[model samples]
Target: MRPIRRLLVANRGEIAIRVFRTARRMGLETVAVFSEADAAAPHVMAADVAVGVGPAPVRESYLRPERILAAAKASGADAIHPGYGFLSENADFAEAVVAAGLIWVGPPPAAIRAMGLKDAAKALMQAAGVPVTPGYLGESQDAADLAREAGRIGFPVLIKAVAGGGGKGMRLVEEAAAFDAALASCRREAASSFGDDRVILETYVARPRHIEVQVFADSHGDAVHLFERDCSLQRRHQKVIEEAPAPGMDPATRAAVTEAAVRAAKAVAYEGAGTIEFIADASEGLRPDRIWFMEMNTRLQVEHPVTEAVTGLDLVEWQLRIAMGEPLPLAQAEIQLSGHAVEARLYAENPAAGFLPSTGPLNHLRLPKGVRVDSGVAEGGDVSPFYDPMIAKLIGHAETREAAIAAMAEACEGVEVWPVRTNAAFLANCLKAPDFIAGDIDTGFIARRLDALAAPRAPSAVALSAAAEAAVALAQDGDGPWGGGLAGFRVNGAADPAVRLFLDGKAMLGSPNGMSERSVLADADGHIVVFEGGEAIAFTQAAPGGLDESSGDGAIRSPMPGKVTAVAVEAGDVVEKGQLLMVLEAMKMEHSLTAPISGVVEAVLVSEGGQTTEGAVLARIVPT
Candidate 1:
């Protein structure tokens, strides 16, 4: 076994920091490589040695293998760890690391290539007797052939990109009539996203749940499963929350499924950290026979913290050890699961704004203190559009699933981020969902209630009061009676001098509460922001007459800085309420703007392919 004296992480954000944490604990020096945008990131600061990779664009920086390799050499890092994204799963990169004589803290490149593609992975799994979903894996890229296979598999089939992941390049065709168009669309997206248009046809599950097993292997021919995590709480196929020891999973079902995962890993001669994802048909609850292989992630997963919480194991440490040619730490019988653990991902996005990426300076950020928080950005840092907008991961562990859920929700509620919005409120709402709280959930849980969950709420009286009080405290001296106690609480006068405030242009009169349960802050822009119930309410002091500033008219504006991709109508065209007006692409995700009222298109201010700033009017409409 070779010892790794120094380790370099070829990624940034929480992933790099997480690996560095374990590496430091193991008495290894840690090196960090960062892009220009992340030069001042926490990971860089946490490293013993930091190297500049390249510019802010991933192509110029993180994704460039040569730059990372050079950094490793210069930093004298004897080992390299691709922390979960960027080049983490790239087989070529892994091979390159090994070729350069540095230890690669991951699965073998052959294993990665074997399981990188879904169709190929399924074929291999089938050979190894691992259960895979019923599908077509024939080497046929022709549309007609795919449609024929779909018909054979029967209607309500899934046309999924063989190279796709993260919900891209996937379509559910409930009937044969929609198969052709969906296939074409799926192929286009697949080609654009993954550079491969080949797809596979699978029979659709009436109800599906996402469950993945954390597996670890070593070079010494030993492997074991670290139980399972239910990541069914997804939106757009992106996991929002994850929990270990899947809820409603019986011991029998768990054994069968986890054993299959381990078998699949061993079949590839896998090593280090990897996740075997499965799609369970939840119609009859989680059953061994009903679970089928989806795909395998050949690197550490984002939800690894949840598994670590319950398993009481440092997975990264295991990865490092296995990479150093060690055997599995414990046999299957000795590995044990303790308590239930739940994790919520707090992302820099606005749930009410259709979950659009909210990129800006954090300004005021406060994660909950009680939970185990693995954060990417700090209070003074910025959430750039160049990378993933996940601000932090909050993990909660307890004796029971119910207690873990409650603890996770409470932690989410305590999260306070301002200016740049977050999905904390939506996460809390999801935790409170009756079906979710009861462990009755599926992959479509978020989509089924998106409208209600994403709807913007009115500021509460208590929130407004606390915000105005915070504003008063910042605007005036602290010796006044208003600053001494509750601003609007009158000891011996009429309660007529309440503060006037504008919550995003909604005029309101509120009594400032100097002492309140919720967190309140007055920003540098002289605006009052209240944090409570996992939502941030920003209030501006009302102008003389509460001047109308909102685009409540017919102006369709871009929610964030982005490039306009499409315009559906010309000036003067009659449009119905809720009709698609234009499409904006920001942070690599598209946001469709629609008409607010039945109106005539007054003007199209932004052309397709043109860059626009946040809140910029893209199109204007005049009500009929």
Candidate 2:
């Protein structure tokens, strides 16, 4: 294969941006393919040439192999790089690219097809002497047959779709009564998601730690493994936090797992970068022989940066070289790892509000310095409801795992995402959790601690005080309506100006100058409030307090920006608190918004398909 001159990225978002950076560093021209929604995305702007492939949905854009290939040909691209999601792991896409005389910057079509289906991959692993999870992979699609098989395997079996990922088309059957429903649901989801209802049953191994090994191969039959990553911190079977050099892995276990990963890659005659995932029972310390092969990702993974951090190797560089017919640059013995790294996926969602996806114009978007942020959107970019809501990947590297965790937590705290809801604070809490810090993690870690993780920690009094101080500062800058400073001051005023401020769902009393003391004076209209803390008031009133205080109950608002797909309720509709009221489609997922309190709907401020920014009122409910 000729050296890649122009590479077409058949994906969008941060991964596309990431691949472009690597390609540029390798002196390769980059071609970006965007959907209608992503025409103005950062990834498109970063590329040497941008091509519009199709409409907003992924099926029309990224998943249309013909469109991607056409764009590559139009852009004069010699290679196609499928970054992570979309059609990244599609074997058909790989075959088409190879047939079109363009280099595929990933594994061969054979390897991809072999590992495309979870059940097929498991069978291959079992034949290759790789330990496989014990379950039913038989070709019986009858729900009754599956339920019987599940009973034979015992209770607590996991029914997973054979053709998809991201926790879709999967169900856990806890008991016989729930088996049929679970199986039916799993099949329906499978059909909907992957267009295939075929599923396999696996005996659920409780408390298993999710780990995966990154393996790379070249065209010349050379391959190497790059340790493993701990992806146990997950919710809904989707990874939230990932780290390299799995926290409690011993040397022997690491070597064994790495060897197994290398064997798995070599078995497929794999080329380019791939990951062999495994589930390990961490109830016992990671043992050399206890890990079972899960599945192989035939393309680059979202959490690849953690692997990059420890190995000190640019995996994308190797992918480029291998695509150009170069042999692996290093042998198994030559590869070395250092330092631990952690990555937190910063999503445009509110953790306190059921992780509902938020969408809107991002205002005051300031990413943390001294931390690596791989993002596809900018400060003013809208987090479209048509794509993934992940704002950025926050990565931190340090000499030790503990240090790395600390750094990641600090970085998350330092990040300031304004006007959009995000899970930054939740991520910080996860990093600081005792279980996470102690390295006691499992796939259920996040779910088990969901309550604690979702509990909103009230901002400290000091922080509120600081906000008050800031208000005072803003008022004193002559920006307030009381420009002459006499607005807050009253000649022997009888009552204090009772300005009300709502923060974290609680109302607080403060004066115009940011003073919260009871001795503050107020006008008869209560529109102007004086804050007295026995100290000088700092800020003046900007507008009448009634206008600001009129906003209803302190419901947790949408955190990210998004559009309302369906308003489930109407004004005056009585809803049980926490009942689904609407569906907000953001970042490609439908988030069901529930009522915050049991009440009659006061107003339905937003309708279906209405665009909403963070803090925009969708609906209000009054006490029943």
Candidate 3:
């Protein structure tokens, strides 16, 4: 095989950008293929040349083999890199690339096929004497048949999509009564996600730590494992925090798991980069006997940075070399892990609103200065509702696991973006949590702490003061004193002149000029109001628009962009203080907007599917 001079990246987002950076360093020109929605994405901008593939949908763009091949041909690229996801694991696509005279910078098509189907892969592992999870992989698709099999396997079983990854088609049946329903839902989601409804049932283990070994292979049948990553911190089956040299893993168990991973990769004559995932029970310390094969990721994972940080080697470069027929550069004994690393996926989502996907134009993007940020979008780039809501991957490296965690937490707090709600603060909280700090994490970690995690905390006094200062600055800009001066003079001078001041959905009525002084009088909540030292207070009034005084802070709005999918009620709708008001769908997920107080909806500003920019009004409610 000839060395690659040019490569086409058949993916998008951070992975695409990551591969291109490595390819450039290796003196290889990179070609990026993007959908219509990603034309202005950072990955496209970073590539030496970019080709338009199709529309925003995955089927038409990133998943279309024909379009990818066409782009490769147009760019004169000799190899194609299938970054994880979309068509990355499609054996047919890999075969097609090879058949079209292009080097596939991934495992051979046969290897992909060997590990693509969960049932077949499990059988293969069992045959090789590798640990396999006890489960049912029968050929029956009948719900009753699956249910019966689940009953045989025991009460708690996992219904997993055999043909996909990213936790898209998975369900856990905790009871016999819920087996059929869970199975049907799993099948439907699997069919929708991977076009294959074939699912396998597995005995679900409680408190399992998700561990995976990164393996590299070459054309000469040489392979080695690169330790393991603990990725148990997940939400909705998707990984959130990933770390290297899994804590609490003993050397004996680590050796066994890593060896098994190497065997699994070599069994399929795997070449290039691959990952063998394992599920190990953490009820006891990690042991070789307690671990079982879960699945193999046939391409570079999103959390590859953690692996790279500890090894001080670029996996992508190795992939390119292996694809060019190079032998493994080092044996398993020579590979060394020097330090610990952790990676957090920064997403455009609202943590206080059930972690729903957020979409909007990025008004400000400031990543932490000292850490590594792998991202595909930039400031002013649109976090579209059409794709994944991930904004960036923040990775921190340190000499120890604890230090890495601390560094990651600090980095998250330092990174900031405007107009789109994010889970940065939540991530910081998680890192600081004693359970997480002690590495006691699992798939159920987030779910069990959902209420505490999503609880809205009041803004700090400093933050409130800053916001007040900003409000005052805006007021003093000579923008026009429509309502008069600090003396509380009103333009209409009526008993009550209502001027709209958007304050976290609450209405504040006062002389427009009342905003100028450090202290002013206003009406808040049918009472006398006073504003002092950047705070507002409320009291009772004799009339409907009575004069009052108070001091208080402001409200919190949506940080990012998205579409309002549901409005819980209409005007005059009496809602509880925390009742769900609307659902916003962005980046293909739904987020619930809740009521701030027990109030009547005075106005519904946005409807389902209505496009909303950052700070766009969704509704207004008058407190009861």
The lDDT leader among the candidates is 1
Global lDDT of each candidate = 0.86, 0.78, 0.77
- In order of appearance, the predictions have TM-scores of 0.90, 0.83, 0.81
Q: Give per-residue CA lDDT, model 2, range 239-279, as digits (tens).
A: 89999989888999998888899899999999999999998
* lDDT score for candidate 1 against the true structure: 0.86
lDDT of 3 by residue, 479-557 (tens): 3321111222222222223333334335433333323322222222322222321122222223234222111111224
The C-alpha stretches of model 2 lying farther than 4 A from their native spots are 476-499, 510-624
Model 2 local distance difference test score = 0.78
Best by TM-score: 1
Residue 400 local lDDT, model 1: 92
Deviating ranges (above 4 Å) for candidate 3: 478-624
Better of 1 and 2 by lDDT: 1
Q: Is candidate 1 or candidate 2 better by TM-score?
A: 1
lDDT of 1 at 339: 92
